[model samples]
Target chain A: MLRINTRSVQILGQQISHRRLSELSLLIFMMPALVLVIAFVIVPAAWAILISFTNQSLIGPNARNFSFIGLENYVRLFNDPGFWNSLGTSFIFVFGSAFLGQFVIGFSLALLLKYAGVLSRGIVGGSVLLAWVIPEIVAVYIWASVLNFQSGSANQILLAFGLEKQRWLIDMPLLSIIIVNIWRGTAFTMLLFSAALEAIPDTLYDAASVDGASRWERFRYITLPLIRYTILLDFILITMGTFSVFGMVFAMTGGGPLGRSEIIGVYIYRNAFEYREIGYGSAASVVMLIINLTLALVYLRFTRVEWSAEA
Target chain B: MHRSGNSLLLRLSEYGFYLPILVFFFGPISWLVLASINSDPGSAWQIPEQVTLNNYLQLVTESDLLLWMGNSTTLAVGTMTVTVILATLAAYPLSRVPFPGKGVFMYALLLARVMPITAVIIPIFSLSVQLNLVNTFTGAILILSAMQLPISLWIMKSFVDSIPIELEESAWLDGCNRLTGLIRIVFPLMSPGVAVTGLFAFLAAWGDFLIPLIILRSPTTFPIAMGLYRAFGDQGSVDFGFLTALSVLYSVPSILLYLFARQYLVKGMTAGSVKM
Candidate 1:
């Protein structure tokens, strides 16, 4: 029923040098995904760099016909105080949410959950994960009302405790967004660390105890060293993820309260879409891209080290 | 007796440490749930005098909730189909066949996954405009699928790696072509991998807000996420019932998927990070 010419290349009960899949078919198989990514991701990323030199507008005569304006947008961005403020806000956000809040709390939760009762793990771990799986807008909605001015749960709790109500989004916008981000993100690190912890054998801990090592000493000597790669990978992923957060802050504060909570993502949207300054926005995005690429390169290095060590 | 007392204290401290975290995480989510059923919901978390289904009913009868949900489902399904098909196709070759620069190509994919989507919005927007793909579900689906391709490929490649090549080789010995062997034997065995990839793609495209906001202009094309964002942003007179109900509706699919993929989440997250 089928052609046997290709099969002639392979004899029955005899070994072939390699599998019979052809190179042409493999290339054909890869073409669709390769085209999609190159057309969308790689092309757009490179185009952002090219357009950063132009005086493009979202609408107007310039939209149809724009001329190159080298370094003008970048020069203006570097000179502006607002851009500096946005950059600073973004770093604080990444540092606070990814490093201080999520990493510490998630790591602690994982460590505790290892020895925790079933009930405690069910309640605590369940809540953290529920926060994560909900849509970003839903998280934004929940937090917006939670930090509402007059009738928020936060205020009600404060009043019930006889403390003055603080304006969360307005008075302390930075801290507010940071708290929201940490709440949404802590689940990932917790899961990652829990799996890593579970993989380590009980014998390692038993050996440490037999050597008379203290709890802290055992963690330092064994746990940290074993999970170091996981820790590095987690940092790389979360940091980039946090850097790209836009919709939550965009809907909540619009990077307002006098631009106090304007992260870089919101700033790009504001400049490009809201203000119709595509060229300027492109310049800002180029800076953010550089930062992300740098992080990715560092990630590659760590992973490469692991790959070579495996060999 | 002394050792027993010390162990009891240790247990007490462990629960004590967990108590605050549980409270911090659950308090707000509990409020969201409670507010949804309250007849007259407010910002403050409180029990309603009597529970009512009026909010959910209003969403079904009055608003464009169904339309938005329909659009969201279309986008999600489209994305899932495209991402899964392409990823599976690409992964088969990568798993079995050796190609030039394969290692470099894999690392490039890792970079693509971590590259910030927000940073490339300008060109993506303009490209869509040029292609006349603006405001089209096809455009949005294509873009979303591209975004999800990197990690999905890794997941699929690893899955394909687990299925021994001998099974396929044996099929070939029976005069089966590679495509037929794949469709008949290999795919059935890798359904779990396909499910994982499909689930991730669905969750992503369903819950995404940014792509819809940029691509779609009309309310007719809005997804549930866009609806939720618009309703909640109306500061004139807050519709707590409707907003809370929509939130519940919006999260249902995600929560269902999470429940289904509970065992796979850890594996899914580490797919690209861990060496195969």
Candidate 2:
């Protein structure tokens, strides 16, 4: 009885000590992530917010020389033609590329895959997967070549068909960028929709089929409602994802042919990196954060979604 | 004949759906392949003279393309290592422990994920400059690792959630400490998740452009994305053959990496979809 009692006490003591150790180690382990957030994310974000109210330039020697200007930067931004044009351009690019393209294509493809035999599904799925697998920069290179004006493969194919060889980059910059974005990004939608579709029991489809529902009917009634939340989730994620995209636009159009394809990301990049308007750039970034957060919030509100379900 | 017509229409639509996807998807890649092998440089934008390996050959013999590849590999592997370690440690408790503000921490990470890198580029730029880490491999790797950690943590946390707590408890009853139980029992089951998370982190760091573009101005430290951008823009007109060759070469490792890790991705992503 004494031996057993001693063993129980030892186990209790060890458990207490281990719990304390876990707590200490947890703090130590969490430090790197915590410090990184403070240094790169939290502090920088705070700095960005503060600097937005200042009149700083890319040429400034330090952030100290920048004087506080209350809302002038934002006031100027609201009145600036470039900012307005960029905001409009941003809406077009984001909705056209992200919302309309990826969502429709992703949803439709999911429907097709659901009905498609396993073999066709793999083939179709794998082909889309190839585009996703290739790096965004590489995708840009491929599309850039295809969209070439004078001697592009696109022109060659058009010429072979006796069609006029139009200037893809110059004539349709926004459309060109949108198409490339769609090409590169559809895979994400495809993957997400596939999982979302699987969450739907096959029995629903069988029930719809037995009711003599046509493919379109079933899709309209059954598939669409079921994946509505997934679609909304996909929308928010893709919208935010596309908002921040740079490499594709930078490569395919350089936000140009007279800045026709200039989304907010490329616009901010030019202001910050190219023109050296550090403070102005930070202001633009601050605006971007606001827009994104608002979108995410709006998304959560409409869909009644919470991100903490642990998948 | 009526049934035959219906079947034919169905088949045609099936083919039709695939046709656009195929043409849009494969058309560019096929052109890339042809351009990568074309003999004349400008011929890539035009009709190809003939298929040749000269472009690929030129990449190796002429430039620091190989060095860029090496740097990408190092950064990717390094980011994967640090991210897996850090994310796993943090995620374990976030998954298991009933800590206060776990939701806040999780939300903060998500917010970090969505906040564009461009937004924070200036402050990060200033900080990196102050640290004298501009154009350093270590700096790039550190930033990339940190950038990728939030997403990795979310994914791995879900993976950990799938394992029953009883498994850990049983191990503890066998006289194992929490760390030991995590290392010995839990980690083995979580290997698939780790592999996928590592692959995602590796690809993200490997293919990233903007960070490298701003941070590493030197040609010596360029990743493939930046290198391709430079090759395209440095000249008045794009260098089609060389760019295509470089793209093809760059894609090889990632494609291989994908094939090796494809199984893990579905699992990882399903686990990750919780946050979505």
Candidate 3:
């Protein structure tokens, strides 16, 4: 009995060592990705935070000799009306396109497609996806041409209706970008909601109907409750994405006609590359990061509360 | 009879709802195609007196469009390959191994996705300069892969998690090691996920405008997006015909990719949204 007990203990020790070796091997597997992320994302982001406190520049006198300015850039950022204006513009852009436009229209489209025939589904799905699949630059160009002052198709259509041609990009640049963004982004929301809606069992709706519930009531009680998580997820993603939307707006209006469409992203790029104020740009970026992080935290908290309540 | 009529009305309203969407989505693209072929450059919206392929011919002959496309393809393929391999390697351990600080790694991935690219571009730029990697395809690929890695890792990890570990364990029982099991047993099942991840990585790297814009200085290394932007800048408001033609050509690959992989693309893209 004593010999058996000693033998079993030796076997347990071997098992422990084997597990440790495997764990170490697993760490090896994780090393490449960890190195890449740390090298590229983590390190650069940390450096950006450091650079924000200093007077860095891409060109001019500060290019060679830059020193730490210690919150001066942040102070300048707060006092700058352009920064405030860009933030306001970002808010409006996010609210208008992502929240109001994409959510409403995409949800409506998803609900519509739910009942539509196969042919309509194919056509509508294909058409909406075309907008999404095309490159951002190409989409911007398409919109640019369509909204051009002289020979734009939009004005042509208006002319056919005996209406006046409006200078879209010049007169109402912000509104124009909002509309363009809505057009570009609604497809994603639609696809997301469509998938969510599909996951809802039809049996619930049938039971609700049998219980004398109206279509709206059924949707409110059953569909809404079931897909609330999906809606939240969509809102979080689209908000963050729209907040950083640069390429399309830049290509279309260059955030122009007096910075009317200068969203935060465009503001950062303009400061960083065009004006060559790398430090100020980094400051703005840091602020933007804070805003995004706050938004993410808020949503995460909301989801957590929701999940805990359910549990 | 009333229910049937109600259903008909619903269908008609659905069609009505679809009309505007169809127009909104397709109108710009259709107009672009029409304008590309229109003989008169001055009036892009006008009915063409004669449709011509001259614009396309001019684009190819006058510009370095082909070269730019080649560069774009190389950047995209390189980014996709690197991102996939790294993501897969990392995802396996993440899914299978029990380690302290695992949650930290996951959160780091999430934070990477949440943080805007602008937040890091400055340091990345300066770092690239310091490393003397500026204007190189390697630099662009590295940066793009890094930017795309978090999402790819998240996606690949989800895929790996969905796969049963029991299958791998069964392989282990068959006298196979973990690496061997992953390669032979797990990889085959994860192909769908990998394919989707690859497609996304390819699309993202292919369509990226900002990273390439900053990193690549030489015109020779310009991707299609940069090439188009340069062409637009050079030509300005004139040459609508050539510009539209270039736009159409620029859109062809992505459009073709969408047409081919719409099902997988939709499924894969939405999978993360719903799951998360």
Which candidate has the top score in TM-score? Answer: 1
Local accuracy of candidate 2 as per-residue lDDT tens digits, A1-311: 43555765566576876676674565455677667666777788898888888777666564558788888878877887777777788889889988888878877787788778888788778777788888888887777768778777778778989999979989998988888888888878888888777878889989989999997898799878877777777788788888888877877787887778888878777887788877777788789889988875655454322345331
What tens digits encode model 3's per-residue C-alpha lDDT throughout A150-257?
Answer: 878778888889999989889999988988898889988888888788878889888889999998899899999888988888898789888888888887888888
- Model 3 chain B TM at 0.89
* Candidate 3 pairs with clashing backbones: none
Q: Over 4 Å off in model 2, which ranges?
A: A1-27, A60-64, A117-119, A299-311, B41-49, B263-276
Candidate 3 is graded, for docking, as acceptable
Instruction: Kindly list the per-residue Cα lDDT of model 1 for residues A1-311, writing each as its tens digit.
Output: 86656653455334344344453465688899999999989999999999999999999999989999989999999998999999999999999999998999999999989888798888899999999999999999999999998899989989999999999998999999999999999999999999999998999999999999988998999999999898988898789889988888888888989999999999999999999999999999999999999998987876642232111
The local lDDT score (0 to 100) that residue A214 gets in candidate 2 is 91
Please tell me which model should have the higher DockQ, number 1 or number 2: 1
Worst 10 residues of 3 chain B by lDDT: B267-276
Could you list the CA RMSD of all candidates, in the order they appear? 3.8, 3.8, 4.3
| TM-score per candidate | 0.95, 0.91, 0.92
Candidate 1 lDDT tens digits, B5-122 = 9889988988888877877788888888899999989999899888999989999998999999999999999999999999988888877776667777888888898898999988
TM-score of every candidate's chain A:
0.91, 0.85, 0.90
